[model samples]
Target: MSRPPRHDEATLLDAAVRLAAAGGPAAVTMSAVARESGAPNGSVYHRFPQRSALLAELWLRTLGEFHDACLPVFAEHAEPHLAAGAAARQVVAWSRAHRERAVVLLHGVEAFGRAEWPAAQLRRERQAARRVRQAVTGLAERLGAETPLDLDRVSLAVVGLPLAVVRRHLHAGTPLPGHAEELAERGAIDLLRGGGS
Candidate 1:
């Protein structure tokens, strides 16, 4: 049998994540991934035929991982309000636990050259987006979100508010505060409860 390859796709993608986290999406070129991962340039090319492919894979993987972490939080809780709170808290918790990936996520798919992604990547991206939309809709329905504004509020509670907390701390290059999870959880519940107005 031929010798096993040294650097795998995951290793190269991880290197891309680090590069993107440190210098943004523009930093994650093929050669840069090779250098960061200590893999041969050929290995990087073998795994990702082009820079756009690498970027797409990196973005998709990060998004999938994030969903994996947060979706279960929504599913596990019996009460919609409690589920919303836990989901919000889980966002902060996931970000803190996966700072580098979170940084990559903050930049988003467009920054990762989504326009240039191959058809397969685009399909995968759409599937992930649909999954999130479905989850959000289910949660909103369970929360008795009746109007457009009510659905918007649920979206804010579960996604926007927690992301705001993560974005603020990440952009500032500061550690997420000790109260980050609590703040996210409380902010979500408050929004869901009509902001206590």
Candidate 2:
């Protein structure tokens, strides 16, 4: 059998994550990933083929991982408000658990060259977005949302509010505070209950 390659796709991707986390999407070139992973330049090219491909894979993987962590929390609670709070708190908790990936996500898909992504990558991005929209819509409906504004409130409570908390700390390169989960949970519940008057 032929000898196994020294560097794998996952290894290269992890290095890309580090580079993106440290210096944003502009840092994650194929050459940079190779250098960061100690892999041959050809190895990265072997997996990614182009800089846009590498960026797309890195962004999709990070986004998929985040959705995996937060979406399940929505299904775990029977009560809509409880589910919303849990989902919000999960956003902060996942960020705390995966700091580098969190930072990568904070850079957003546009920063990852989404406009240049291959069709397959773009489809995957849409699928992930659909999943989030479905979950948020379901929760909002369960919470008696009747108007577009009501849906917006639920979206803010479960997604926007928690992300704001994460963004504040991560953008500053500061660790999330110890009470982040509680703060996220409480803020989400308050938003859901307060309503727009």
Estimate the TM-score of every prediction: 0.96, 0.96
lDDT of 2: 0.93
lDDT by residue (1-197, candidate 1, tens digit) is 99867799899999999999999999999999999999999999999999989999999999999999998898888888899999999999999999999999998789999999999999999999999999999999888778888878888899999999999789778999999999999999888876431
Local distance difference test, candidate 1: 0.92
Worst 10 residues of 2 by lDDT: 188-197
Q: Which stretches of candidate 1 lie over 4 Å from their true place?
A: 1-4, 195-197
- At residue 42, what lDDT does model 1 achieve? 96
Alpha-carbon runs more than 4 Å astray in model 2: 1-4
Error at 85, model 1, angstroms: 0.1
Candidate 1 matches the true fold with a TM-score of: 0.96
lDDT of 2 by residue, 68-116 (tens): 9899899899998889999999999999999999999988899999999
